[model samples]
Target chain A: MSDDGFLRVADVSKWYGDEQVLHDVSFEMDRGDVTVLIGPSGSGKSTMLRCVNRLAEAQEGSILLDGEEVLSPDLDVNDLRREVGMVFQGFNLFAHLTAVGNVALGPRRVLGLSEAAARERAEAQLERVGLGDQFDSYPAELSGGQQQRVGIARALAMEPKLLLFDEPTSALDPELIGEVLEVMHGLVDEGMTMLVVTHEMSFAREVADEIVFLDDGRVVERGPPDQLFERPERERTGRFLERIASHD
Target chain B: MAGATRPATVRERVADSDRSVGRLLLVAAGALFWGWLVVSWVNRWLGGVLVPVGDPLVPPGAVEATLAAIPGIAAYAADAAFVVELSPEIARGTWLTVVITAASLVVGFFIAVPLAVTRVYGRFSAWVSLAYTELLRGTPLLAQLFVLHYGLNLGSYVPDTLSGVFARNVVWVAIVGFTLNGAAYQAEYIRGAIESVEEGQITAGRAIGLSKLETIYYVVLPQGLRYAIPSWTNEFVYLIKYSSLAAFITVPELYYRADQIASETFRYTLIFIVTGVTYLALVLTASKLMERVESRVSIPGLGVDRER
Candidate 1:
C-alpha cells in the first residue's frame, strides 16, 4: 500500500504450469533509478520484469507502476503496458513495418497521437538510439544490433514511466552488443527509470544504481552495483559472479 | 572485409559476357524445342479434325457444299473472325456471372475473416464457426444452389415485390450459394495464414500496448493476409470458373452462352473453343493482378518472399 517508490513489486511469485519460475520476490525502484537483474539462466529475472507490464502475470504479488496497483483485477492492462515499455531479447520488431513505423505504432494506436505527431516522436526516439539513417529500413534489412535499437526506440516512443529490458544485448552478435548497450547507457545518463535483465556485468556496473542478484527464482542479494558485483556478501552470489566472469 | 578491387580486366569481362551468352543460347534452344513439340501436337490434332470425311459415294465438292449449306461454316468463320454472334442474353448472362463471382468474393472475404478469427482463436463460438465452415464445405455447391433455388424457394415465402425479384433472377440464387460456399474455403486459407504468424509477434504487439483485437488487426491479419495471397488467388480464379456452375441454374454465364450457341448452330467445337479461351483469359488476368498485389504486401524476409 506504500507509495514510496515509483515502481514496486512486492511478494511476487509466478508459475508456468507445475513449475514455479519465481518465488516470493520483492524489490522497489525510485523515480529515475536503474535496477539491473542478473542471474543464471531460468533464474526468473525476465519473468519478474515481465510481471510489471502484466506480460507475464504474477500469481501472488502486487506490482505498482507510478504508484497504481498493476496487479489489480480492474487495471487497464494496455494502459499499464503503455506506462511500462519493454525491449525483448529477440528484438521483436514488426517485420512488415519499417523501423520508424514500428516505433510509431504504439504512439499512434495507444496514445492516440496524430500521425504527424507520432511520426515526429518516433523519429526523435529512433535518432536518440543512434538510428537516424535507418528510418525507412525494415527489421530484416537492419543488423541485429540495429533492430534491437529500434526495439528500444519503439519502447521509448511511448514515453513510458518505466522501461524493462530482457537480456537486450544477449541475442546480438558479440561485435554488435556495444551499440545496443550504448543506447541503454544513454538512457541511464538521461535519468530514465529502467529495470534491466542482462548478463552484461559491465553495463550493470557502470549504469545500474542498484543490482538485484536472483538465483533459483529468489533474490539472493540486493545492493549498490559496486558492492553487489565486487563485494558480494552471500556465498552463492559470490560463486555465481565468479562463474559468469569465467564464462565470459 | 576485403579491400575494394578494380573493375574486371577487358579479357575477363569479355569471358564473362561470353559465358552468359552461351547460357542464354542454351535456354533459347530448350524453349524452342518445347515450342516445336506443342506446335506439332496442335498441327496433328488440327489435321485430324479439319479433314473432310471422304465418302466414295459423294464428291469432295458435294460434301463441302453440304457442310456450307449447314450453319457450321458460318459458325467456324464467326469463330475465326473474333466476332462470334453471341446473343445479348449471353452477354448479360456473362456479366451476371462476373457480378456474382466478384460480389461473392467481396462478401465472402468479410464473412471469412471473422469466421476464421473466431474459429482459430475464440472460446465457445469457435465451434459454431467450425460447424458452419465444415457443413458448407462438406456439401456440393450445386446441391446448395438447388436447395436455395428450388427447395427453400424464397419466392413463395417473400413479399410479392421481392418474390418476383427472387423468382425472376436466377443469378441471385447462384450468388447466395457461391458466397456461402466460397466463405468456407476462404476461411480455411485465412485461418491457416493467421496461425502461421509467429507467436513472438503477438507477444511483441501486446508488449507495446496493443490490445488483443488491435494486435490481430494491425499485426496478425496484415501478415496473415499476405501469406494467404497465393491460396486466396487460387480461390479467386476458382470462383471465376466455378461461376459457370450458375449455368445449370439458367444464369447464362459464358459456359451457358457457349452451350446455347452450340445448341443453336450445332457447332459445338467452335463455340466451346472460344468459351474455353475466354475463361483462360479471365484466369490469367486474375493471376497476374493478384501476383502484383501479393508482391506489394510481401514482407521482405518473411513468408513466400523469403525464398528470394
Candidate 2:
C-alpha cells in the first residue's frame, strides 16, 4: 500500500477486562477500496474494524484514519462515529422510524440538512440499495436483506468517509445474504472506502482489494487477495482459507 | 402402605387428589361470597338503623316549610333542567380539576421516570424499589392528603392572604397530594415498561458508542415510553378517581360540589348521578385522545399495535 493510504493501523491492541482480544495488529486500507478481514469466530477481526471508529478502543498503538490519529488522547469519538458509519449484524435500525425516516434521521438531525434535502437524500440512498419502493416500510416489515440495505443507505446518508460492516450478512438467512452483499459490492464498484468483517469467503475473494486474516488476537496475514489467500506463505492462513472454503 | 396388597389404581388416586383441589377452590369461593354477603348485610342494617330506611330525613314537622320551599327548589330544578345554569360551575370546576390533574401528572412524571430508573437498575438493594412501591401502593390517599394539608401544614407555608382562599380550595391540595401518591405507583409502571424494552437494544446502542444517557434518551426511552403509554393512561384514569379523595379535604370537586348542592336542595341521588356522568365523560375523552396520539407516533409502516 502507498504512504497516502487513507486508514493505517499499526500495532493496535485491545482488551476486555483482563482478556486481550486483539494483539499487535497492523494493516493499511487505501482510499476507495474494500479490505475484508476474515477469520474464525472470536478472531478479533471485527474488533479491528470497530477500533477504527473507536466503538471498541485500542488499548495500545496507533490508528490513523485519513492520515489523522483517530485513536489517541484527543480522539473525538462522536465525530469519528459520524464520519465512520457502521452497519450491525442485527441491523439496528431505529424501530421508531420508517425506512425513509431512519435514513433521514442522521442527515436531518446530525448534519442539519433541511427536511427537503434530508428526505431527498434518504430516498436517493434507499433507491441506490433497491429500496426505492419500500422507502415507507419499517424495519419490522422488511426482510433481513432489505433491512441491511436500509442500514447501508442509512450509513450512506451520512456521507461518511468510511463504512464498517461487522458480519453484516451473518444474521441473514443464506438466501437473504446476496441482497445485502450486492449493495455492498455496488459500493465497492462506486469506489467507497470500507472495512468488512465477513465469513463470506467467496465475496471476499471476489470484491476485496486486500484480505487481512486474524486469529485469537493477532494478524496472521495481510496482502492483496491473490498474495494473501493463494500464496499466504503461512500455515495459519492456509488452514483459515481451507476452513472458509469448506463453508462453500 | 408398602404392605398394601395392590397399589390403588393410579387414575383413581389422581382423580381423588384432583377432586380435593377442586373442592378446596369451591370452598374458598363460597366463603368469599358469604363474607361479602355478611358485610353488605351488616352495612345495610347499620345504614337502616341510623339513617332510617325509606324515610327522607326532612326537617321535622316541615310539611308547610317544604311547601313554602318548593318554589325555590323548583326554580333550582328548572336551572338544572335548562342545564346551562350548571355549565359555569361545571366549567370552572373542570378548569380547576384539569389544572390540578395536569400539574400533578407533570410532577409525578418527572419524579416517576427517575424513580423508575432507580427501581429498574438500582445497585443498592431491591428494597430501594420494593420500599417505594410498597409504601406508595400501601398508604391510603386520605392519610396522604391529611399529611400534606394539615400534618405537614402545607397550609401554614402559604401567605395568610392566600391561605384562607387557597387552603379551602381543593385544587392546590389535590395537586400536591395526588402527585406524590401517584408518582410512587407510576414509578412501578415506568420501571416495568423500561424493563420490558429489549435488553439487546440497549447493548446495540452501547455498541454504537452512545453514552448510557444517550442510549436511554435516544434508543431505550423512545421505545420504552411507547410501551409505558397505555400503563400511563391507566394511571391517569386512576388519578381521576383518586381525585375524588380531594373531597374529604374539601376540594369542591364534582363530588364535593354535588354534596353541597344536594344538602342545599335535598336531591342527593340526582346530583350524584350528574357527578358520575361527568367523571365518566372525562375518562372516556382522555382515552380516545391518547389512543389517537399513540397511533400517530407508532413505528411507521408497521401495523403492530403494541399494547400495555
Candidate 3:
C-alpha cells in the first residue's frame, strides 16, 4: 500500500448465506487519483464498491479511510458512508426532488446545514459540473448524460473524501456518455479521489491514474494505465482485452 | 296429403303436415306442470301438509302486497334527515368506529413499518416476508373479526383488555376487530410501497451517510408514500365501511341506529338501501381526494424522457 493512500480495502469478504460474492479482495487508493475498476458482469466489482461504502456488509475484512477502520463492526458506519459518496449507474436521484434539491438533501439532513446553505453548496457543485443552468430541473427532465452529471454533482456537494462510481456511463447513450465523462474528467482535474467501474476503455485509458482489472471476484492485474494498457503481463489480460474490444 | 301436397313452396308443405298435431298436448304439459304446483301449494295453504311430507306454511302473496304497500313504504323511506335525526346515536356509533379505525391505523403503522422493513430487507428467510403477506392476505377479514371479537373474547386466561373489553362495550369489540383485520392488510400495502422505492435511491441515501433507518424515513418512505397514496386512500374507504361491522356489537353507530329505526318501523329495505348509498358517497369522496394528491406530487416528465 502507498504511504499516501486515502482509502484501503483489506481482505474484504462477503457472502449471501451459501453463495459467496467477494473473497478477500484487497486494494489501496491514493488521494486525488481516479482508480477505475474494469471487469466482466457479476465479477463482484460493484459489490466491492458497495462494501467500501458499507452499502453491503463485509463478512470478513475491513475498509480503512485515513488510517481508520471505518467498516469495523465497532465503527460508526454512517460516518463512513457520509465521507464516501457513491454515484450509481442508474443515477439515483430522488424522483420527488428537483435536481438542486436532490443534491442539497444529504448535507441538509445529515450535516445539519440550513436549507439556504445547503442550496448554496448544491448550486456551486452543480455549477462546477456545468449544470448551473439546470439547477431546478428534476432528474426526469434531464437526459441520461445530464442526470448522471447531476448524480456526480449530488455526490460532490457533500464534499466527500472519496467518490465511488458504479458504471456511471453504462446507462447513458453513446453521445451522452461524453458529457458525463467530461464532468468526471473535470473532477479528476481538481484532484478529487474517485473509484469508478466502467466499460469505457478510452475514458479509463485517458483519465485513470491506475486501472484495476477484476475477473471472477479477484483483481487480475492493476498498475499505471500506460503500463497495463501498453503491455499486460498476463495472457488472460490479452484475452480479456480481446473480449472487451470485440464488443464494439 | 304428404305426397299430393308437394305444393308451391317447401315451407307451406311442411307446415301443412305438422299442423295435424293438436295444441292440446303442449297445453296439457304446461297446465299439468303449473296446475300440479298450484294444487299442491293450495292444499298446503288450505290445510297443513301430512306430517313432514311438505312445507305447511301459508303461501304469501308478497309481490302484489309489496306493490300495494309501496306508497306507504316510501312515506317511511330514509332520507338525509334520518342521518340528521340519528346524529347523536349515529355520532356515538360513528365516533366509536372512527376511534377504533384511527387508533388501529396509527398503531398499525408502527407495527407494519417495522415488520415491512424486516420483510423487505432483513437477512432472515424470504419466507419471513412471504408468510406475513400470505397470512394477512389469505384469511377472510370476517373470520379475523369473529376470532378477535368472539373466539379470543371467550378465552379464559387472556387479560381484561384483550377479552374482558368485549363483554362490557361495543367500542372494545370494534377496536379489537379493527386492529386485527387492518394490521394484516396494511403490512402488505406498506411492503409494496417500500419495495417500489428504487434500490439505487437507498444506496444514494447510504452514500450520503444516512443510516438504514434514516434512509427509509427520508428517502424510501417519501417515495413509497407516493406509491402508497391511492392504495392508502382506498384503505380509508375500506376502513369506513369496515367500521360498520361495529354495529353488530352494541355500538350504536350509523348503521346500528338505522337498523333500529328500520326494525321498529319495519322499513328494513328502504333504510338499508339508503345506507348503501351513504357508503357510495363516502368511497367517492375518498377516490377524488386520492386522485388530486396523485396529480399534486407527480412531476411532468417521467415517461417521455425515457424515449428521448
Candidate 4:
C-alpha cells in the first residue's frame, strides 16, 4: 500500500462474471528490481501480470505505476500500455511482419518515429537479442526460441519503464527455453525492471530480487529466493515447492 | 465361391463399360465444342480475307478457293463467318463487362472493409452490418437490379452527360446494384478472414499500444486479407459472371449484345454459342489472373496448407 514504490498493485480484485479470479492481490517492485510470481495453475498469477498493463481490468484495485493511478477510468489505456510493455507466453509476433517489422511497428506507429529511424531502433533491439541476421525473417520462419527473442526485442523497442512477462518460457520447448532465458538474463544484467510470472524456479533463484509465492489468487509468501526455498514460513509454500520440484 | 463371384464380376464389368461409354461421349462432346471454338476464333480473324477492299493477305478469290478445297472446314468457315462480323461488337461489349466488374470490385472493397470491421468489432452496430449482409445476400441480384432500375428509377437520377457515353443510365444503375451486392459478399469473406486470425494477435497488438482500430487495421486486416485472397478470388469470378445480370436492364454488355444479335439475325444457336464461349474464356482468364495475384501477395508459410 506504500505509494513510494516504483510500481505498486494494492487490493487488486478481478472477476470474470460471477467467479473471482484475483483476491486482494498486492505487490511492489523497485526500479531495476526483478520480482517473480510463482504459483499453481488457476492461481491468478497471469491475471495479476495482465492487470498491471490493464490488459485485463481489475474491477476493484488501485494500480499505481510510478505514482500515476493506472486504474483510473480517465487514463488512456494505450498510453498506459506504452509505458508498461508485456511479453506474452505465446510469442505473439504479427504473422504478416518480419522480425524487424514486428519490433518496428510500435515505434513507427505508436511512438511516431520515422520508418528509417524505427527500423534502425528495431535492428538495434534485435541485435541486442542476438537476432541481427534475422531482421528480414518472419515469425513463421523462426524457431520458437528465436521468435521469443523477437518478442522481447519488440517490447524493448518501446523503451518502457516496466516490462511484464506472463510465463514467457512456458510455451517454449525444453531446449529452446535456454535461449529465451538467456535474453532475459541479459536484460536483467542491464538492469531492466521486470515483473515475471513463471515456473522456472532456477531462474527465480538466480535472478529474482524477490520471489512472491501466490496461491489461490493471493500472495501466500514473499521473500528472497533462498529464504523462501530454504526456510519457508508457510506450510502451503513448502508443499507447493515440493510438488513443483517433483515435476522437474 | 467361384460360381458366386462370376455373376457379380460380370455385373461390375457391365457398369464399368457403361461409365466408359459415358466418358467417351463426354470427351467427344468436349472435342466438338473446342473444335467449334477454334474454328470460330480463327475465322473471326481470317475471315477478313473475304472482303476485297484492301490488299488481301492472299488474293481474295485464292483464299476462298483454298477454303473451299478443305471440304468440311469450308463448311465450318462459312458457318463461322458471322463470328467475324460480330467480333467488333462483342469486343466492345466485353470491354464494358470488364470495366463494370473491375470498378464494382474495387469500390466494393473499400466499402466492405468498414462493413467487415463493424461486424467483427462493433459492439452495438454489429447487427446492422449483419442485417445489410443478409439483406443483400438473401435477395437475388436480378431482383435488386430491377428494384434499382425500375422501382427506384435510379437511371433517371443520373445526368445525361454521364450516361450518354455509356448506355444512358442503365450502366450506372447496374454498377450501383453490382457494387452494393458485391460489398455484402466481400464483407462476409473479409469477416471470416478477420475471425480466422488468432485472438493472440489482437492482444499482442494492444500490448504493443495499438488502439482497437489500429490493431484491426495493422495486425488483423493484413493477415485477414491474405487469408481472404482465395475467397475474394471466388467473389471476383462470381462478379464477372453475375455482371451478365446487368444486361437485363439493357446495359449492352456481352450478354446483352449477344441477345440483341441473336434476335435480330434469328441465329440464337450460333450467337448464343459464341457468347457462351466468350464467357468461358473470360472466366478462365480471370481465374488465372487471380491465381497470380494470390501468389504475389501471399506471405510465405502462412497459407492454409502451410500452417504449423
Candidate 5:
C-alpha cells in the first residue's frame, strides 16, 4: 500500500502478556476522513485506536502520521499525544477542575499558553461545543452528555491533527447520546480527521466516510458505508451486522 | 389492646430505666471532669495572688487565713500554690512542644511529597522509598530520638555557637528525628491516597499530552492530597502527642518540665495530670484546625462532602 495516505496504520499487532489482542491490523485514512471501527466485544478495536497515539504499544507495526513514524521508540510520546487528542468512553474529565479548567489545562500546561489566553481559548472551544453556559460546571455536576462535550472541548482546545474517540457514546444514556453525537457531527462537518471506535450504527452509517468491520482483531471488511452495509462481501460481516441491527 | 402497640413490661421498663441512668451518670461524669479541669486551670494562673499586694480593699494574707480556717480547704490551697508555681515553666515547655511539632510537620510534608511520588511512580526509587518507610516505621519514635541524640551523638557535630541556641543541640536533633519519622508515615498516607485516585484520571492527564511525572503532579496529587486530609489530620494529632518523646532527650518539652516539677515537689499525680490535659488541649485544637483545612480545600461533589 502507498505510504502517501495522511494516516497509515500498517500491520499493527499488540500483545498483553502472552495474549495477542491485535493481529496485523492495517488501514488508511485521508486528511479529512472519518473512519469508524465497528466490531463485536473483545475485537481489539479500542486497542487499535489507542496504538495511533501510542497510548497502547503496537509491538509489531509502524503507524506513520503525516510522514512521521508514531511507533518510533525515541519519539516523544507527549508530543504525539498532543497532536492526537482522544475522547474516552467514560468522559474522563478532571473531576477536580471546572469545565473551563478542564479544557484549559493542556494549553496552559503543555502549550504554555498564558492563563488569560488559555482561558480565552478554552471558553471559545466550550462555546464551539455548545457548552458556553457550563464553563464552571465540574465533571460530577454535569450530565453524562455534557461531560463528554467538555471532554471534546478539551481535545479540541489542543488543536490536534487527529482525534480518537474510544466508544465515545457507549456509556451515555440513550437520550444523552444524541447531544454528544451532535457535537461529533459538527466536528465531522467541519472536516476534523477522526478515528472513532463506536457501536452507534446510525452514526457509523451517516457520518462515517469509510466503515472498517473488525472481528477477532483483524479487519474483516473495509469500504464506503453504503457498500459495506447494503451488501457485505464477507459472511462474518453480514452476521455481525445482523446481530447489531437486531439489538437496535 | 390486641391492636395497640405493645406496652412496656416490668422487666423492659427496668432495663430502659437502667439505660437512662447509665446515660445520666456518663453526662454527670463528663461535666464533673471538665469542671475540675476548668477550676484547676484557673487556680494555676491566679493562686499566687492569695495575698494581694498593696490592695486597700483587702488585707494581705486575709484570703489565706480564711482558707486555712476551713477543714478541707487548706490542702486544696496548698495544691493550688504548687500548680501556680510550676505554671510558668510548663507554659514555656508547651511552647517548645508546639514549635517542634509544627517545624517537623512542615519539613516532613515537603520531603513526603517527593518520597510519595517517587514510591508510586519511579521504577528503581520505589524500592528505596519502601525501605526508608519500613526502617523508620519499624522502630519506636523514642528510640529514633535516642539514636539521633545519644547513638549518633549529634551534639558533637554542632558548632559551639549553634549548640547554645538549640538547647545544646538536643532540640534540633529531636526535630530532625521527628521530621524523618513523620516523613515516612506521611509518605505512606500520600501514596495510599494517590493510589486511591481513579486510574482513568492518569490516562486523561496523559491523553492531554502530559508526561507521566507531570500527570502525577498535576492530576494525581491534587485529588490524592484531598483524599489524604482525614489521615493527615490523624498524623497531626499523632505528631503532637509523640512530640512528648522529645522530652526523653532532655529537650525540655512539656513532659520534661512536668517530670522536673513532679520530682521537685513530689507531686507526681498533680503535675502529670496537668501535663496530660495540656497535651489533650493541644491535640484537640490541632485536629479542629486541620479539619477546617480539609473542608476548605475540598472540591464540591468530589471525594469530600461540600457540607463538611
Candidate 6:
C-alpha cells in the first residue's frame, strides 16, 4: 500500500507441491507503463504474471492493484479480474463462439450489458485489433494470427484497468507473429498499463518502458529498456542478454 | 473430336438410364416372387381351413362363402371396435405413458446435470455420484420398477393428499423408478461429455474471469450436451421401450391395454402384432426427432463432422 505505483507486488513466494516456482518476487509498475518480463524458459516469468492476477496463487506475500490487496482471502477475485485483462499464449478463444461472441461474452455476462450493446462494444474492440471482418468467424476457422487478435479483442472489450500478456505470440506462426504484436504495440501507443511476459526481444526493446529480467525465480535486473539492453549492471543479466542476442 | 464426343456422351447417358431401369425391373421381380410365396403360404394354411379349396372335405361353394367372410373377420380383428370402442382407454394409457417418459426425462435431466458437475468438479461429490450411478445402473430397470411399486409400500409414509395420489395412480411409481434409473445413466453421459471438452477451454474461461459455475453453464454444458447426443439418443429410445414395464405395475400404458385386449378376445397374435408395430413407430419417431436435434446443435468442426 505504501507503493504509489498502480500495481505493486511485494515479497511473493509460490510453490507447487514441494518445488518452489517463485521466491520473494517483488516489483512495481506505474500507470500506463508497459513493463516487459524477460527470462529463460523456467525462470518463473509466466508464473509471476499469473500470480499478479491470481490465476496462479502466491502462497506468501501480498499483491496490491490500485491500492487494494489482491492476495487477501476475502477479495472478490472476479471483480478484481474485471479490472485486469489477460491474453494467454495459446489464444484460448472459445471454439464454439465466433470472434464477436467471444468478445461480447464478458460484457454481456459479467458486465451485465444488453445483447445489442455488448455486441456493439465487441465489434468496436475487434475492429481495434484489425479483426472487424472476422466478427462471425469461429476460433477454429481463424488462423493463429487472427485467433490471437480476437483474443486481444476479447480482453480489450472489458476495458480493464490493466492488461497482462503471457507470450501472446509464442504459439503463432513465424509469419503470423507480427499481426498480433502490431495490435499490442497499438495498445502501448494508446497508453494501456500492460505487464507482458515474452521472448520477443525486438518487441520488448521497441515498446517496453521498463524491462524486468528474471532468473531462477528472482528479479536479476530491471531498468529502462535501453539501459537494460545496452548496459547491464549484473553479470547474470549480461550473460542472459548476450545469449538471447546470439540466438537472433 | 467434338462429333465423336457428342455421340459418346449420349450413348453413356442412355446406358446409365438403361442400367437403372434394369435394376428397377430386377427389384420388382424379386418383390413379386416374395409376395406370391407369402400369399400361397397363407392360403395353404388358413385358406384351406376356411375355404375347403383343395380337399372337398371342403364343399364346392365354401370358397365363395369363405371369400365373403374375409372382410368380416378383417373388420372384427382391426376395425372400429379397436379404434372406436377401445381407443379412449388406449388413448388414456398412451397419454399416461407419454407423461411418464417426459416427466422422468425432465426430472432426470435436472438430477443428472448437477450430479455430473459434482462428480467432475467436487471430490466428495464424485464418490457419492459414483456409488449412486453404479447402484442404479447395475440393477435392472424392471427390478427398480418392482421395488418402487410393490416393495416400497410408498403410500403409508406419505401425507393423506399425496398418499391418495400414490394409491390411485401407479404411474407415479413408474415415473419415480424411471427417473432414478435414468438419471444415473444420464449423469455418466454428461460426465463423459464434460470430460471430453479440452482443458484449455476451462483455463480460458477462468482467465477471462468467468465464475466456475458460469463457465460450466455457458462454456462446458453447450459443448458437453452436443457430445452427449449419441449416448442420449440411446437413452431416449431405451426410455420409450422401457415405459412398457409400467404395464406390469398396472399403470395401464399401451402394452397393458394391448395385453388386456388380447386376453379378452383370445387373439394374442393380432393384438401383439399391432402393439409391436406401435412400439416400433414410437422408436422410429424418437430416433428421427433426435437426428433433427443432433444436426441442429452439432458444431462445424466437432462431433460427426470431425472427419470432414
Fnat, 2 decimals, each candidate: 0.71, 0.31, 0.76, 0.73, 0.69, 0.44
Q: Considering only N, C-alpha and C atoms within 3 Å, which residue pairs clash in candidate 3?
A: B93-B253
Error of 2 at B89 (Å): 8.6
For model 5, residues B38-119, the per-residue Cα lDDT tens digits are 4443444475353332121233255456666789788676555556556566666776788899999999999999899889
Candidate 5, residue A88: the lDDT equals 100
Identify the runs in model 6 with alpha carbons over 4 angstroms from their true place.
A1-3, B1-94, B155-168, B264-270, B302-308
Which lDDT value does model 2 have at A97? Answer: 72
DockQ per model, Cα: 0.71, 0.24, 0.47, 0.65, 0.69, 0.53
Better of 2 and 3 by DockQ: 3
What local lDDT does model 1 show for residue B279? Answer: 70
Q: Rate the local accuracy (lDDT) of all candidates.
A: 0.83, 0.77, 0.74, 0.88, 0.88, 0.82
Looking only at chain B, model 2 earns a TM-score of 0.68
Off by over 4 Å in 4: A1-4, B1-67, B159-161, B305-308
Highest DockQ: give the candidate number: 1
Q: lDDT tens digits, residues B113-198, model 1?
A: 99999988898889999999999999988888888878887434545564454335666677778999999999999999899888
Model 4 residue A58 lDDT score: 97
lDDT of 5 at B70: 85
Candidate 4 to truth, TM:
0.88
What's the true lDDT of residue A86 in model 3?
87
- Deviation in angstroms for A26 in model 1? 1.2
Q: How well is candidate 2 docked (DockQ)?
A: 0.24
lDDT digits (tens) for residues B1-308 of candidate 6: 45554445788989999999996885576555335334433444476543333332323244444544687564453343343344333444555666688889889989999889989987898899889999999998888888877899552355566655433557777888899999998999999989988787877787777899999988888888888887888888889888999888887788898889778988787667766755665676678678899998766565444324
lDDT of 1 by residue, A1-248 (tens): 22359888888999999999889899998999999999999899999988888988899988877778999999989988988899999998897899999999999998999999999999999999999999998898999999999999999999988999999999989999989988998999898999999999988989888899999899999999889977999999999999989988
Error of 4 at A144 (Å): 0.5
**What residue pairs are clashing in model 1?**
none
